[model samples]
Target: MSTSFWILCHDLKGGGVIRKSGSIIKSIRQHTDAWINVHKLIPRDEERITEISNTRQRMDYYEKAISLREAEDVASLQEKLGRTLSKAEISRIGVSKLRLFLKELLRKRYMDSVPLIIPLLEKEYNNTTRKLNEINRELSTLDEVKLKEKGRAFHDLF
Candidate 1:
């Protein structure tokens, strides 16, 4: 049977006993194509997910350094002032000021490396965050593509 006849028969508004062999085959092909495209995306998604995980690990390491350095600064500040400080008080003064105060203390005590370490940690943390955001955006695009293909296949059935 001709494809045009099958299409015309399927398109009839009030047809009874209309055959849809061609339409069914087309729908099946769409579904198969959708499945294949989605499967092709799987390895790329896995690699991006792994990259995100590694980026998060890098972010966590930088965050840990920030926390440790901040905590040490807080303890030193508290000890120097001979008083405990509230979290609000510590935060209100800000990290840069706290680091500066600690730098002065370290300078007086002849210790070194606070200035170098803080900047490096901040830069690394920011870079990791940027990388993570880019990866997430790419994954979102991939998911959107898969969704579009799946929608096309599903809706073509009717």
Candidate 2:
């Protein structure tokens, strides 16, 4: 018999189904069960995966901005000092300390560039830091328990 016939029989009340067609009925029951289990859950899972991807991308951009700012600071310092300053030295001195030192140096010796460079660098650094903190808060709020329960792997989504 066609699946539609079985479906019609299933819809009718008191439709006496035969034992010979038990396998077909069971197959239909399994299909319905799978459809019900997966239908509503997948969209929610995909949404979360998208959220995770977007959050990570934002974090990466901020982190890269921070790194680029550090490199630019080091380059500027090296240019003014007329000596090589390794990135490792800047890291060892620490970012805030280095920025403070650079600001002071620029103010004392190269006073003209102070207005143009210091304010913009400070603003960019502060904005990036604040955005990174906001991204962290967003990450903390995101829950992956539902995806885990659904047997969805993060690796597969990436």
Candidate 3:
């Protein structure tokens, strides 16, 4: 049971923020029972993650650079960043490039269907929370027994 932490940023209008987030974390924590923290970003960071602001402008600049085959400029930019972009990083950027693509492909009716995804997410969170509570209870019991044993050993020595 390997546990991996995820930083999920969900759109606010979808509703069930507490239930969905809590349940998913709860379910996973049950199996591997790892630590996970889920948080809602402020509007500014949300805009940055969703590429709704200056981040979008930076993305556009990079996309134009790639399309033009401006190798020297790209190299300079990469050097300034102190690291080369991995394929995964580039793929993520390409996905961001598809924001407009999704908007164009999905009509208002389809956009309205987005809330359907929340239930599955909520179930996952609930299960994880339950498991975490079970694990915590077991640990508490073990600690109590250990403390009692130590007390008896000290009394016997006296």
Candidate 4:
């Protein structure tokens, strides 16, 4: 890979966080040979993969999920409601983002308990990180897609 391509691919954040996933896909399809193969890459042991069985089964479930989503008329209602969902659900949500959000939230909620003079994450850093870690671990293995669907996109995370 070229230097620019390598840098973009290895952002080292564990996953991509660009604002426009669709745009990235379009760019790669138009300009590069770096298509992703989820089946080839995803580790099978990490989670359950329901046996789709056949096209009828796949189509039936997909249509059902789509209809349910239409009934709810919300972007991610299907995922939140435990209906069939797509990979965008997982990619848009991530462990690191959740941890960061929780960190800022705790600081905001307990501002008086935290020092104002010192930089954030400087004073009582260990304590805060410890609590966040506990929270993260406790919340681990949550349906990442569903939790992400619940998060607000009112402001761009990019």
Candidate 5:
């Protein structure tokens, strides 16, 4: 079975699902302490993000995808997806949007608002780290099993 992975830069808010591209995932791996999630978007199919070129591109790809609304026509879609934008562009869009969202939510001025945000961020970081470690362990085990099976096969043949 063929497998694919996407490296994404997730935030305190929900993460953007990155479209797996060339070395983008590798770039992400080089920078950022981001945690990865293995998703089975389809039954019996799994995906992961291995590397990203840099933190900037990783952030940009994520922002563009998130900011992309439902394009009404092929022209609009092409315009949006056509040329690549710089890392700065991506970071600007993402940060601006997130700020706007937070501003709106904060406008409510609820009593528990500040307290709520802190715990949520902490929880997200904790969860992401835990998941990353778990995935590494699982992958290591799988590799060991494969190696053992290969050794057994060789012995049987001899």
Candidate 6:
């Protein structure tokens, strides 16, 4: 049977159904002849920012399809697919554990599509970190905040 027809027969209007469809989508390339590169389905751009935005949109769509919110193995899943895409509290967690969390998150989030999207995610992560550092640098240059922290003991150390 065609993948579309099979999906049509399955009632996928609800969140639960959508998740099931997602799991089926994951298993398709493995269990059957169906194989797809989500990257090819998406539009590409020359500019890195545009490319990142488009990739992120597609990622969001896939994320919705296989949302970990209702997974049967939910207990084993990490929070927010273990993605601290913007801000990772590195100081609060173990480095190896965080690495494991990221690895698992990527595995679950992208699965077979990781080859196409890993570079995008990596670039996006680097971009996010760069922008965050820029913001922090700008904040550090502010005289008011510096003055406010003058008397604090651990402010400089932390």
Give the candidate order by descending TM-score. 1, 3, 2, 6, 5, 4
lDDT of 4 by residue, 1-158 (tens): 11122122222331342225555545554665443221212332222212212123444465587666554543465656777556665433444235445756776878866566466557579789889999999788688777676675533564
Predicted structure with the largest lDDT when compared to the true one: 3
Q: Judged by lDDT against the true structure, how good is candidate 6? A: 0.47
For each candidate in turn, the TM-score is 0.26, 0.26, 0.26, 0.17, 0.23, 0.23
Encode model 6's per-residue lDDT on 62-115: one tens digit a residue.
456555433423433345477432234432243324544665677687777878
Indicate the residue-level lDDT of 79 in model 1: 95
For candidate 2, the lDDT comes to 0.52
lDDT of each: 0.53, 0.52, 0.55, 0.48, 0.52, 0.47
The 10 consecutive residues of candidate 1 with the worst lDDT sum are 35-44
Q: What is the C-alpha lDDT profile of model 2 across 28-139, one tens digit per residue?
A: 4566531111112222122111111212345456558878887787788889999997766776443635544665676687777778888999999999999999999998
Give per-residue CA lDDT, model 3, range 1-158, as digits (tens): 23233334555632342355567446555764455444335333332122222123445565686666545545665788899977654443433346645555665757777698678789999999999999998887787778899999999999
Q: Write the per-residue lDDT of candidate 1 for residues 1-158, one digit (tens) a residue.
A: 11111111222331232225445434544664311111111221221111112123454465588788888888888999999998777873535355446646777666466676889999999999999999998887787778899999999999
Clashing pairs in 1: none
Better of 3 and 5 by lDDT: 3
Q: At residue 154, what lDDT does model 5 achieve?
A: 96
True-structure Cα RMSD, model 2:
31.9
Q: Positional deviation of 57 in candidate 3, in angstroms?
A: 25
For TM-score, candidate 3 versus 6, the one ahead is 3
Displacement of the residue 143 alpha carbon in candidate 5, Å:
3.0
* Candidate 3 accuracy as TM-score: 0.26
